[model samples]
Target: MNTTFGGKPHVLILGGGSVGLTTASELRKTLGTEVAITIVDPRPYMTYAPFLPEVGAGSIDPRNVLAPLRKILPGTKVVTGGVSAIRSADNTVVVTTEDGAQLEIAYDYLVVGLGAVPRLLPIPGLAENAIGFKQVEEAITVRDKILANLAEAASTKDPKVRKRLLTFTYIGGGFAGGEAVTEAEDMVRDALRYYPDLHASDIRFVLIDAAPFVFPELTEDQRAYVLNQLRERGIEVKLETFLNSAENGVIKTSDGDEFETDLLVWNAGVKPNPILMDEESSDLPVVTERGPLMGKLDTLADLRVNGAEGPIDNVFAGGDCAAVPDLASGEGKFCPPNAQHATRQGKRIADNVARSVQGRPLVDYYHKNLGVMATLGMYKGVGRLMLGDKEIDVRGLPAWAMARAYHVYAMPTLGRKAAVLAGWASNLVSRRDIIGIPQSADPRAAFELAANSGPKKK
Candidate 1:
């Protein structure tokens, strides 16, 4: 390995998300001062994505879902920047810091965990109007938007305006969309108790998906059960449907359904970071085929980048950005880009990197998925746990409990876990807080207006 400074191998990680955070933590713990570690990301904090649904529903505080990178990884260097280009041939990466300063950092080893972004379509007004649900801020916006709409609908005497404000349309029915729509619906239901003028029937939730069913990960019976539960809550489940246009608050669907919605959430899917596919930005070998796993870094089971013949030297990648082979499922199968795989792959890659530094044989990553779980509102959920070769299906309260337990265990720090648990416990005894700080979206607006106001003459 090339040593750039202090005669120690400098490991540069290109993301501060699940994989990056785990890898950095483990490397610091295992290698100590033997290696110099640096993590570069646009955000200084790592957002725990699984609890985003609860955060959107006001069940969890947004702060509880974020762990600061600097505080968590004390010994490692944290750079708040976005990578513009990866010049692996020169052993340097070009990064643009938050303040727009460019830097070229040299590293002996490179770890790619840049993760994915929303796979948006070219539908009309989609980019301008649709809200995303990927990060903690987006989750907070979703919560605030829903609450703000409800409050506005309650005061509006115009029936058409009220109907439009109360209608919330969600596109895509995957795990993220399914949980998000359901949880948002629950919040509206709970908040209706406070508004005597608004009833449950006044609010409308429409979930649209291009597929025939939502939660394809669930079994046939389980999927049916989820659909039934959602319909029972008065949420219109429109499967085999697509959003044709979302122009000017009017939603036009492929099924010829037209409606006006105040809020539109796009959670269809995600693609690997654009830098991985762009030739100018990255020279890495990425799968460019037109498929579900397209535009991902071609990686091996040992978490090393795939070269023309074999693994590349000192270049490792895992997480949503890499097409890692699913060794446990045999050949021709790749691991799904999910948090469950990303977190485990992080630990594996860290150990393998340490082994490479010590001149030891590296180990392959293989782990059977433990289960699939989704929460529907507070105490309702669905889960499928893998017990050996058999599958155990669970729903309702037990599944909800299991989902919470799993997330608490999966969350990075004990402090964050305790905070999340405290929020959930408090909600059990008190009513859900329906107050929306819409001003948070533009916190400086009021101050800016005051500053522009002309001084009054005495």
Candidate 2:
């Protein structure tokens, strides 16, 4: 570790999601040449998760939702790799690059913003069939898969095959699942106009959740309104139900209902990044509680890692991977793993780290919940905003506009915001892009086929 005060302190940040990216940007702006920062993540860009639903529905281009890390953080070093192990005791981390080479990076300060991964259940055939909705790539895949299914279903004369292709089943009816299914249904409805054989009534959209209600973030009235709106659009909301199995395109539910679905979307939930729980990272204290937040790094209100004895020296953590205290929510409550909290926590932790480095006092992170918003479809949505002690409920077009405007303002860069707006504007003036590029899933298949087709001509 470079302990010399005369040289710039090396700060190593894990993950390049909203939290990590925000921290690096803020630190670079504040400390300038006083600190050297390095960020390590598997992806080269940060996906604006809030726009993922729109991306999946073709409302926004996939590239617009992603902000390249290196471009945004000009002064920082961005390493595209996955952290294999974190030996924090010695201030070293082993990162496995894409090419299978490993590099050991040492730092004077460490930031844990590794983010979370999809929490998949062990239902039968889920691993082989289900698609996730966490990243930009996943969103693009979902969009393509839906379009492909719709095209295939339109051409198929077999009733069973058509039904299977048209049926889209989504598990877990939280904000992610609810918004995704609704937007997808809207896309399918819009696309059906071009397919003479397909009708709105022929499509089946099922949203199944173990909970009795969806969108737990919304109030009772808002939830009811959202549910009613969905049902009015011919969507099946199976509450208090669980997916028993999804084998061979057959969906078996806890209610004993079985159906076939070619598109199975799994938006169940998310857990902290597995790196925090890996045996190699045993040195870091992790939450052992059996819940959604299990395996997260145990962190104090100041965003410092809580070791067995006390706060770990020169180490801090925030974002989805860290169990940060929700100071505004009273005692024993940790911040939820959402983009809002993650982004705010990132800025706070960055300031605290800078303060600690400059021998100044560290500040604790505290922010009140700003409520939640979800766009049901085009020109339709619901939202609940917290204004002091009072709550304001919004629905329909205004809510949709508010959601879009807020996301645009919150998006990291002006370039990305403009791109997203351009995409939306282009969609307004033109028809929705229903064409699916099936070759994207396997780009090399055509090349490989041609290569194996007999010997080269003399």
**CA lDDT scores, all candidates in order:** 0.93, 0.90
Cα lDDT for residue 41, candidate 1? 95
Best prediction by lDDT:
1
Summarize candidate 1's per-residue lDDT along 286-391 as a digit string, tens digits.
9978998899999989999997677887899999999999988889999998899999999999999999999999999999988899999988999899988889
Error of 1 at 433 (Å): 1.0
TM-score of 2: 0.97
lDDT of 2: 0.90
Supply the global lDDT for candidate 1. 0.93
lDDT score of residue 96 within candidate 2: 96
